[model samples]
Target chain A: QQPVQSPQAVILREGEDAVINCSSSKALYSVHWYRQKHGEAPVFLMILLKGGEQKGHDKISASFNEKKQQSSLYLTASQLSYSGTYFCGTYQGAQKLVFGQGTRLTINP
Target chain B: IAGITQAPTSQILAAGRRMTLRCTQDMRHNAMYWYRQDLGLGLRLIHYSNTAGTTGKGEVPDGYSVSRANTDDFPLTLASAVPSQTSVYFCASSDSWGRSLHFGNGTRLTVT
Candidate 1:
């Protein structure tokens, strides 16, 4: 099943913080995050497999909750380069991945 | 280093015509996938192959077909074009199971 993403769109200024959430109705084995700029391919940011694990680098981080079948991506101290469309992909059985509708993040100076 | 390459950066097809989107990966990943992205609806899986010689239907496989004859290439064919088929198609591959994917730049196809 396709995961549901919250905050269809968000606007923020430089140095602000934002959180994008994705949740599924069925059980999930893994959650993947990707960011895509207009007219470009999606670039993978990270993937979380463990229920209670959190991972990230630089100013981005993510939290996965296996029990609730939910994942949240955190963006701190946002920069102008951070403006893009964020997608959350939920890995299903047999290596199938379904992506959410996406959240458009706009960061201004 | 071309991780993944998709042919015909953009194309325009007439209805009822057959067209194929080409994809090749140099990473030698065992898994390959085809997804189509549309405005507002996001990316939808069209087809996938776990390994060479095996293919499976994805969430939105209707009207589209894919073949994985080898590890380096996965091609998607549309038997008959329809206006609704107009979208940006992306090719992606991963090492296996849940590995991170390497995506192609994508092919923008317009069906008229």
Candidate 2:
């Protein structure tokens, strides 16, 4: 089944912070985060594996709570380039990686 | 500059026509996936292939089929297209089981 994402949309100014959450009903083997700018393909951000440590890239970071089957993406000091639709894909067993409904984030100066 | 490439950037097809979307990656990833994105539905997995000569059904694979002929190409086929199949289709490749997925620009397919 597809995972659920919170805060369907969010708008913020530069230097602000935002959090997007993703939760699944079933056990997750790993969680993958991606960002897609308008009219472009989704770009890989980071991946959090079960029993693995939380990881981050530059100003964007993520945490995975294996017990709750939830993951959260954090964007601190958001920049204009951070404006895009964020998607979280859950990797359960059965060779499937299902994506969430997506969270649209906009940042302005 | 090596990455995934999708053909027929955008296409408009009539219902009942057979259509196939092309995808190729030069990274030689072991896995490839097909996903359809609607306005509100995000991206839904339509089909996937773990390796060449192997295929698997995804969540929404009823109207779609896939073939992994080689390590670099994985194409999605719709035997009988329908209006419901209209969406932006993306082709992604992953080196690991479900790790980093590099996506193509996507093909906007409209069936009417």
Question: Model 2, range B1-112, lDDT digits (tens) per residue?
Answer: 4799999899999999999999999998999999999998999999998889999888899999999989999999999999999999999999866568999999999999
The complex in candidate 1 yields a DockQ of 0.84
What tens-digit string does per-residue lDDT give for candidate 1 at B1-112? 5799999999999999999999999998999999999999888999999999999988899999999889999999999999999999999999886568889999999999
Going through the candidates in order, their DockQ values are 0.84, 0.80
User: Which candidate number maximizes TM-score?
Assistant: 1
What candidate 1 keeps of the native contacts, as a fraction, is: 0.75
Report the Cα RMSD per candidate: 0.8, 1.2
Candidate 2 residues lying further than 4 Å off, grouped into runs, are none
Candidate 1 lDDT at B81 equals: 94
True contacts kept of each: 0.75, 0.80
Q: Which one is best on DockQ?
A: 1
Residue range with the least summed lDDT across 10 consecutive positions in model 2 chain B: B93-102
Please name the candidate that would achieve the greatest lDDT relative to the true structure: 1
In terms of TM-score, how similar is model 1 to the real structure? 0.98
**Span of 10 residues, lowest total lDDT, candidate 1 chain B:** B94-103
Error of 2 at B4 (Å): 0.9
